[model samples]
Target: MIELFGDATGNSIRAAIALEESGLTFEPRKVALARGEHRAAQYLQLNPTGRVPTLVDSDGPGGERLVLTQSNAIMLYIAEKSGTLLPSSAVERARALEWLFFFVTDVIAPNAQAFILSRDSTAAHGDAVRRLKERAFALYEHVDRRLAERPFLAGRVFTLADIAGYTITTASESELRWEALPHVRGWLERVGARPAVERGRRLFRSDA
Candidate 1:
């Protein structure tokens, strides 16, 4: 079984969704970031960086071992290893990777950093958050257009691209006006309606 270490939020959500999409059985070990569990000696030994969502693959020659860190890396690893939720065509696969990068760099990272850095003061970081939100909206508009043309980001079927993008983009729903981008709004709903996504979400809540 795959062992995932992270709380049910942000990047951890991405890893959970990907694992569900891969149809693999896994266990989630929540490293409560707020409670400083990530900084504890046990977790630091596995992840020196003290980050969440460290995946441990237990099928190693000796025993279980940490396989990967970083949400996107874990997503790609699950996709490639399971040989599912990825495009069969070369062009589609490339498109999937492109969209994955676009979501991580353009949408997730900037806004997340802004929120994390600005968690203490509302006024001090207002301008930074506004700029980040604007950039996020612009990126969402681009995604909306692409999604309008295709059923999913990578062109046709549901893939890791959607898992990555949807997981991150959905985080800012309350802050973002997705209604302005009707196509994106509808796409997000459909993506979230999947049984696997729902199951993943349910699993997370149960764990919490």
Candidate 2:
């Protein structure tokens, strides 16, 4: 059995979405970050970094157990295990990976740093936060351009690239200029309408 320990954060949501989309039968174990549950001894044993979205596979390779951290790594692992969420063609897979890293590094990283800066009270980081946010948001135009040429980020079919792009796009929806990014707006709507995406999004909800 697979157990996914996570909260409702973007990284956790991404991992949950990948598991759901991969058609994996997994249990969602919510870690209440608000209550500092992630820092508890039990949880820390699973992930020393005390981060959300840890994956525990009881039936792993060679019939052994596997514990994995890092949201992107977990997503890729799911793809490899399930033989889905990635293109079969090596060329297409490379494109998928390209866009996946684009979202992970170019988009999500800046916004994450901006979020941290915004929360820091030791010094005034408003300007820095603004700059980071601007840098991240501006990259959406590139996504818009890419989407204008194809149905999905990588190509015709949805893959890990879409999964990565969808979560962050959803998180930053309000900040995006929808009117100017018609293609991205359309892509967002299409991806958001997936049933698995819906279920995955609610996996860590308080009511779930």
Best model per lDDT:
2
lDDT string for model 2 (1-208, tens) is 9999999999999999999999989999999999999999999999999999899999988889999999999999999999999999888899999999999999999999999999999999999999998888998888899999889988978899999999999999888888889999999999999999999899999987
Against the true structure, candidate 2 has what lDDT? 0.94
The per-prediction CA RMSD against the true structure, in angstroms, equals 2.3, 0.8
Q: Candidate 1: where is the Cα deviation over 4 Å?
A: 60-64, 206-208
Q: Estimate each model's TM-score.
A: 0.91, 0.98
Candidate 1: tens digits of C-alpha lDDT, residues 1-208? 7898988777888888888889888888878787899999999888889988799898733665657889888988888778888899999999998988888888888878787768866458877778887887677778888988888999988988898788876777887676668888888899999988876655545453
Residue pair clashes in candidate 1: none
What lDDT is obtained when candidate 1 is compared to the true structure?
0.82
lDDT of each: 0.82, 0.94
